[model samples]
Target: MYNIQGYFEVESVNEATALLAAAPHLLVIAGGTDVLIKMHHGQIEKAELLSIRKIKSLQGVVKLEDGTILIGSLTTFTQIANDPVIKENIPVLAEAALTMGGPQIRNVATIGGNICNGATSADSASTLFALDARLKLQSNQGERVVPIQEFYLGPGKVDLKPGELLTQIIISPENYRGYGGHYIKFSMRKAMDIATLGVAVICKVKQGNILEDVRIGLGVAGPTPLRCPEAEAFARGKTISPETIAEIGKLAVKATQARTSWRASKEYREHLVEELTQRALKAAIVKAGGEAIA
Candidate 1:
């Protein structure tokens, strides 16, 4: 049972924002994925609870007039994984969603909760980062959209202001138009294990030989989900040869500052970053119907 405190079940976005503004120590709960666990362990203290799970506004995926995809904040991982539009366009995200915990967890865990938790090993994070997703945050004052890459301040920390609630995630159409990508989560076990390292690669292929554009998103290899700009730049306009792929892998490792953790050693994490980066890139190439130069 949660500690005795005030509770608010907000049914609309405005009500949620108003509740947040009034309760300085209020904690928002959607799907209760991360928040309940913390509360159970007594990790959360002296705070009123605000439940946004019933808010209908934050519950589905929609395509905008301009072809951008808008995913409501409360959409569950299961909803994301099985959504036809998501699978058809940005399947890398769906694949990532499938690898998060088990069916039960995915069924209740909202994508908003996952992103808001801001874990370094957040499953959906790397894929969304590679897709160059943006988040819409709102408060009583107003709303603003922020690039996902800038939303993280550090491990277990985010840029969300006290009364601000993340409302939606937006993905530009250009990212999913002519691109293929994959998310590879390396964990001790296939299910219910946090990623030791995760790599997401989205690439636009040209003529089955060259890469037109590339984005590499890394997880559990740094303080936040990281986009490898240097490696992306290096891969662009380069023939996807064995040597080029190898060099890009090295660059990805160089871009990360992986540390020794209970799950793996620093050296081992670096090795995974190098090997997985190459594998993800190669897989993306194949998915894009391009052949890596041998």
Candidate 2:
């Protein structure tokens, strides 16, 4: 039912990169959840498919000597949700992974493919953004590490260069250590739906009630998943309270460039941004051992 020019399965990063470098037209496929759908709709035709499912090295979670976590690109959402390391440390990513489609989709949907697809509505994007994750990209030429924020170029586009493949997601210890985080996905339905808006908040609390530092990531807010530096700046060193939380929400809205779409209007999305920002921050604050603000 689909037009395919060629199909190849690769078993290693080197093999995949070689193939990519030689055949620049080849489309990399991992879980094939998004790519196949596009193929079915004729959005993609006569495509040469390169499957990376057999690549063993690209499929697990590892903690490095430096205490940074390296998540292989092929890791499934189900794996992420159940991984002990993810739950004990960067649980916001696990929570985001769980909110993705149903169990079936989660079983095969990969973290790497999700990121490479460059969808702003991707449940994992905001969490990774809040975590300040980095991407390791490999090519036949060499490898390069890019900040996650720099990976996205626009809706449905990423900065992946020709012959380059995303290999690992890196999370430094400082990003997750002593931080409590929460992710909120606002959508039309609770299951099997893309986010109309997603907000992720992670913060460090000190002296029981003061916010030592904070990071906020918003999805479907603009051309890409965005971090609210202004809101984060406002929260740092502040005591958690209703007033502080309210102002943080307002500043979060200032970072968005929401636009009218079939899913929601710009004004409506902006409203959700402000409301959800406060809610997620409150939840994160509590998780960080701070008193709940009313």
What is the lDDT of every predicted structure here?
0.92, 0.95
Give RMSD (Å) of candidate 2 vs. truth. Answer: 0.7
- Each candidate's clash count: 0, 0
lDDT tens readout by residue for model 2, 24-136: 88999999999999999999989999999999899989988888999999999999999998998889899999999999999999999999999998889999999999999
Best by lDDT: 2
* RMSD (Å) of each candidate, 1 decimal: 1.2, 0.7
Shift of residue 148 alpha carbon in model 2, Å: 0.4
Per-candidate TM vs. native? 0.97, 0.99
Per-residue lDDT over 234-259 for candidate 1, one digit per residue giving the tens place of the 0 to 100 score: 99999879999999999998889899
